[model samples]
Target: MNGDWLLLGRDGRLSVYLPSDGAALWRAERAPAGPWEAPRRIGGDQELLPGLSIGRGPDGYGHLVAWRPVGTDRSDLVHTTHFRPLLAPLDWQPAGHPNKQGARTGTPAVAVDAQGRAHVFVRNGGGGMSMVAQKEKGGWEPWRDLKGRGVQEEPAAVTGESGRVELYAAVTGGIRHWRQEQPGARPVPGEGVDAAVRPGTLRALATSEESTTVLFTDDDSGELCAWRPGEKPMPLVAAAGPGPVSAVRCVIDGHDCTLVAQRSTSGRVAFAAYPSQQEALGAVWTESGPELPADAVVSLALDADGRLVAATLSPSTGQLRLARRKDEPGLALGPWQAV
Candidate 1:
């Protein structure tokens, strides 16, 4: 399979694009390099609501999940997997039943563990958080409610070095965390991590086997902060700024780092980096890249060559633009060129 960068987004419809060929992978039968292949329309004729989640499975396939409304108040969680071969079609399947009588909520969050099993988290019809996993043999398990009322957003999940899965979500009072120590283990909620973070702004990055980093915006100050397993939320920036609209954890120059795309109060979008997991709280965040419009929602991913790629959506124009930076060392993003 090719190690090219894969980007997914939705603007009236869902689409997938390969921005560039990082390695010399065979091209699709008739497709060539440059200007992403005509985006493959994956949403079909259905009304694809916002909130698309993508994860790479252990089998080297990419898994995607999104919510599609069925009735006035109900929506179903649609799933699909894609392979990397040039021109390989995306095979989307109805993973399971609708979200508990068609609950209207944010997009579901999916995480593929080292074992290659996918765990999906979302808000159910009753306004509680729920989850369902794909069985090892095949098929999906029934929906299991984790029981949290007034969930403000979809849950974020990541697998640890010990094979334990940790999940995080914003609740009525604060952010709630749960952990499944092992496969089939009931998810146990942790002590209150913090209550100062803004709802729906939580993003988790599992930087290494033994540690995971949580990033969110302060509810009162709007400043960016970081939290680890047993530490208090420490401010990464002194001044108030928009929390990360999109972030990703990837290795750069053999160092585990986080790339964050944040919007300032002045309505400018720029990229920042947190390079070391060990000194995350103390390390200075290096900012770079040209500012995007305030309305642009961005997503971050690392190409096979470890370069950073960003996809931005302009709501006013309804256009999805792709860009990348290759020369910067560490977290200093170079100038962006539209792909």
Candidate 2:
């Protein structure tokens, strides 16, 4: 009930906004605020908590994951930090060592599992190496080196039913999936090279109480598709324009499945849905509230009863928003309300 949306601004600040009333909650600035709070350096001696990702632990605690300069450039160290929400503004409990010894880690992503634990993933420096971390009983656990894979980018995760954790990472060759429930597991590789791979990213969204589905955009072709265990990856939508697809979020209500995507080249966001997997699907493209201050987006979220909620930013200003449908056909775009 107490979760806020995070925005990464151009000025290198992560803006946190209240989801309830579209209010500006707070901002995490890069430069030190005052003498009491100095700029924290992380991973390979790089500045930690760079303006990028903001996530929530299952307990509804706010988290900001980022990287900083190790020395002067990309070759320097990058650290990953976790900020547990607190009563005082800018107050947070640090996780573990910012750096994974000396490995250069970048583009870190965080997700809260069903059991209320936070999981963090990053691209490590070792040849075909990556790291995964999870919050344990007392503190952040040791980083798990993911080997037997090529260099990867933009890793994302989600908690499935039965406390199963699924992770998707974008690799140069293709995308891969890893199940944490099984220890010492290598990433299960995927087939086919995406032509529109640049804009494509992956995240597992809940489809039901028992299933979490992985969604991604085809970089070369601009197609949106999803995959679940024991099933072939099915195409949900085809390319609409030339831009690379960046972010994707899936929301399932009853039999209706809505896929929302943002285009990097055009800066446009749209939604499309299918009544059921049996029905043909096409873009139902509706107008978004507005361009977020940074890259904040509106996607589908479900309540406990499985009712769908649209998570978006207010167009009037960069505020957070959540909207519900009328539960009728034609999939109308009703009032734009605050989260």
Instruction: Evaluate all candidate structures by whole-model CA lDDT and list the values in order.
Output: 0.59, 0.47
What is the per-residue lDDT of model 1 for residues 64-128, given as tens digits with 9 covering 90 to 100? 67666677766677776655534344545566543556465665777767677777887766677
Model 1 alpha-carbon drift over 4 Å, by segment: 1-34, 85-91, 96-99, 161-163, 184-186, 238-243, 250-255, 278-291, 315-323, 328-332
Model 1 scores a C-alpha lDDT of 0.59
lDDT string for model 2 (170-273, tens) is 67656666666543233343333332343335655546655566666666566666666556666777643343232323344444454554432344445566
Name the regions of candidate 2 deviating beyond 4 angstroms. Answer: 1-51, 68-90, 93-99, 102-104, 127-129, 182-196, 208-211, 239-256, 259-268, 275-283, 288-296, 303-307, 311-330, 337-339
Q: Estimate each model's TM-score.
A: 0.79, 0.64
lDDT (C-alpha) at residue 258 in model 1: 72
Predicted candidate 2, C-alpha RMSD: 8.7
Name the TM-score of candidate 1. 0.79
